[model samples]
Target chain A: MKNKLLVATRKGLIVFQRDAVSKWKVIGAHFNGIPVSMVYEDPRDGNWWVSLDHGHWGIKLHKSNDKGKTWEEVEAPKYPEGTLVKEGVDATLRYIWAFAAPSSDGSNSLLIGTEPGGLFRLNIQTSESKLNQSLWNHPSRTDQWFGGGRDYPGIHSIVLDPRNDQHMYVGISVAGVFETQDGGNSWMPKNKGLKAEFLPNPDAEIGHDPHILLASSKQPDYMWQQNHCGIYRTENGGDQWIDVSDRDGEAYFGFALAMDDEYPERAWVAPAQSDEIRVPIDQKLCICRTEDGGKNWNTLNSGLPQSYAYDIIYRHCLINQQDELFFGTTTGNLFYSSDGGDHWEALHQFLPMVYCLTWAD
Target chain B: MPKVSFTKALKRFYPTLENKIYIKGDNISEILDGIEEKHPGIKDYIVEENGQLRKHVNIFCGEDPIDDRITLSDMVGEEDEVFIIQALSGG
Candidate 1:
């Protein structure tokens, strides 16, 4: 089994091989100074897929069959040529925030979520990417959806139902959660209970900002989201949502969210001060855990920075796989916990600002 | 023939992208073309689809930066050294 953590950072990619529960050795940094938004390792072939976003040039996708040793550019998602470009709307891919291949089934199809708020499905058989025009051209998107700090709307989280690959969920900043039941042919907004206080209409169809979205790996009906306003949970497959943020509301405004596979009710989040501040609350960094389905939240800060910790945790930087939770901070600190979210230990510090983290199981 | 060398930073992508590569070309364009032919995906990093050098990439022929980036028609001799440098950008 491959026991490694692939950490995508602002300037490059770092692979950490686990030596023990507390020991992780840096394998090396790949793509040196290039920005790598996310890295996903193909399980069947043991190949690697990386989403590279150049600050000035644009976005590209690369595939490395021999792990990270060598890479070759592959077909990336692009808008159909001759498309119109507007001030707020985008016609082409600007950055790749998320990439997910369907779970189970040997199909070589890939789902890519990009900035400017677009979702695309690439069928390897045809070797062509088809934009989900339904979501892009949705009537409510143009007027309702707003930009985040990037100043262009984007899909930041993608979750494919492990039990049913056909059911997919995507989280778009300043837009909210979108679900596609009939593959990518159609989409619908699933933000019934989430809130976006910034918008004039608090319950608008679109324009809700969901920082991170996760579907329970074991329970197809369970879903969780850490949003711009607060954290939410849905037990009825997104038909409706409930605000289950910590009652005390210390770090309620955070981007990172993680769900435990063994216990569907157990989850984790790292809250920042607020949308404007974008730092740990009170200058202390901590991981908030919910054991009773968000009824109450407990702060976990044993091994984390306590004071003057002005780091922001990106959505994809916090990951939980096989009962192991990993944390990647914007300040380049990495931590891991084996005993749920109660205790943690530092794995590495002083790496590049982390953009994404995924475990190679 | 002008010899080509890539910045050390590029070795992270391809360990084989060593410094100081020997290629046979009379101009900067052909020299890069030859290098891409030898090293498959390096050209995409250095040049755009419009055939212009990438914004972050700069090519220096001997002691001077290549002035004509579009055509890459800058003259090169048998003993000239071509350097591909990654331009410093925002922090």
Candidate 2:
């Protein structure tokens, strides 16, 4: 028997297979160009969707039906009636940063997040020529950006309820979070406690832009947000949020956050560009875990070095299987923990920036 | 005046765009020129440097393909709908 670990990386996509003995081997490379975002395998089937944009390949939609064996491309996706799409000045690259698949809601759907925070949806899995509709296309969003630029709120993260796919939310680079209750029909702002530190006021009702987001059916309201200012969570489903880290006594800005596959509330996260350089700036890497929900958190830096370690991690660069939580540091360190957050092991010393970590069993 | 509509996916960057009039052209060239009269630079995105349809760009008549030989004049009509899709290409 064998299992696979699928990853979308800067070097392209690679599938790592685990044999009967659990020895990992590089099974395949699906694309050569830069695959900025991708899905390993959908629970529905081996159907995979990858978004890549590297050097004139522009932005692309790649599909694999046979467990990363072969691939197909959908040049254009079908849209609903009256859904008029504007053209881009720069046709060189249309970046698709994130994608969300169907959840346990029994509603089979897909959400693609692109640069400039353009949101589109595939309501049903009919055919390549029939993917339809815009989940949330704010008419005045482009003009309402906080910093007032194109790079604002590109929608890098689309978080779906593992239990109910219809109930979902997305985090924008600068605009913040938007939630949708009816699958992909419409959306509304769910940023109550969010605080965009970059704004003129840090305690404002609006503008706590989110860069990355993670959601689990078990913790529906407890989605994690890796923001430009700091790490936050919405315990009431984007209504109110709280800071997961208290850096007053410890370093806390974060970009990477991972939750347990089996238990959504249990999570592990790391610090990165978020640190304002005043949070102790400890190079000794640390992984913080929260078991009883985000009520409390503790650092699991036992097997880790005693000092001098700082390698920021990306939002999707971490994963957890049961109690085995793993995180990849920009320092090229892949750390693994078995006792939740108490003990740890450095799986391999070097592996690029270690952009992502995933497992199959 | 009969007009052609662009999809929301296309309207993203070009927000000012909605439904455009078909400049009195019988052939694909004339129709594009007509569109250019109303909106400039859009024909450039639809056509190519050599005037060939860009590989990723496709124009459809109902559900049929529209190309140089079978220009808009042959396929497009007041009764028929035209859809121009710029392939949303990605990984």
Candidate 3:
């Protein structure tokens, strides 16, 4: 399994290296112009966290122990000093978006997902870097969360619980789906039966937006979500949720989700244009598989791009493993499908708006 | 000594921060404490964890904008330049 790929672009962090005759190389760009939102690598030691975002120095968390070659500036997820702001929200800790890599069981325990919406937890195996806020002041985060086109509200999907490393899971765009057995110390709102037409009470526990949250590393209670309004599932882990968006007439809102760490009834989504014109639904460019999880759906668009092709796909940019699924697009296009989505390839073209796609070893 | 400089949007987040930095201060808060003692956290992106002066960060000094942004003292000159700048948060 020697494919590296780490694409997290909006300007910076793009390392790709396939080679073994598959040929895909571009291991350079790292922090170049800086707006990376996610990039994690720490298979245990290769150390590299890098989740920066500086529309003007708002969030910065870097660390690269030889992988990106050199870097250090690590204490980044804030909110500890007086910390208590909920009336119209303003505690300021903008943008981290995601990072759930830790749990070799040695419990170096790192799990972040921030941006006006918080959930930090960093341990770093101990060298005096302890972070641990455990869902920050999360009593539904005051007056019940909200924000999706930015004004603060982010924690774009972070799932951990291969089998209960304290069992935690989070995905909050407008705030929905949150769980913690003990690791995060008290929290619950599994978003029961999830759906939020934009809310007037489309079943709300806390705002509901979740635009990507997949946890089923081979069915750890089966879960999958991609919701601004549709596409959801949760067999048990989340307690209750099951919209399973096939949309019947096709195009179920869409943000990007990928399960199948080894097929827990496989999954993958990529439909755009839920209206406000987000791109590629009727403009045609697809990748909508569901080998029985969401009750059948298959529209993997042969080699994709059937028409004018607008494309957006950005919720950590759709990643997969066992049969390799990878994705990238905001118009900078970089697709892949080593047999999981069934057949596709368009390695690179233009290359910049991807946002986040992972796969390290 | 006092040169200072910065703006290139503060190199996004201190991409080595070197637009010009001479050092040895004599005001402007000792040249921002000698450029934050040689760039360690770059004065929290131009001041305001409480140090104040981040009303969209301005500094200047050689031409004038540093109106004692919280006792910056404003005096410098070894061939003073200063500058700093901020306002340009996202296009």
RMSD in Å for all candidates: 4.6, 10.4, 18.6
Q: Which residue runs of candidate 1 sit more than 4 Å off their true CA positions?
A: A20-22, A85-90, A125-127, B1-88
> Cα miss at A274, model 2 (Å)?
4.1
TM-score of 3: 0.35
Which scores better on lDDT, 1 or 2? 1
* Total residue pair clashes for candidate 2: 34
Total clashing residue pairs per candidate?
A: 0, 34, 0
Q: For model 1, how does the per-residue alpha-carbon lDDT over A98-155 read when each residue is reduced to its tens digit?
A: 8888866575777888887888887766657888888888777777776887767888
Candidate 3 lDDT score at position A275: 46
Q: What is the lDDT for A114 in model 2?
A: 62
Model 1 chain A is weakest, by summed lDDT over 10 consecutive residues, at A81-90
Candidate 1 per-residue lDDT, tens place, B1-91, comes to: 6788888866655678878889999999899899888887667667754466776788999979999887799989999999998888767
Which of candidates 1 and 3 is the stronger one according to DockQ? Answer: 1
Tell me the deviation in Å of residue A357 in model 2.
4.3
Against the true structure, what is each candidate's TM-score?
0.82, 0.69, 0.35
Compared with the true structure, what per-residue lDDT tens digits does model 3 show for residues A185-248? 7778899888787778888778888888887766777888878787888778888888877776
List DockQ for all candidates.
Answer: 0.14, 0.04, 0.05
Chain A TM value for model 3: 0.36
Query: Which stretches in model 2 have alpha-carbon errors above 4 Å?
Result: A33-36, A76-93, A103-109, A123-140, A146-152, A162-164, A249-251, A261-264, A273-280, A305-310, A348-350, A354-361, B1-91
Please write out the lDDT profile of model 2 over residues A90-185, one tens digit for every residue: 222245667666655343556677654566665445543332234334654544443323443466777777667777787776677888888757
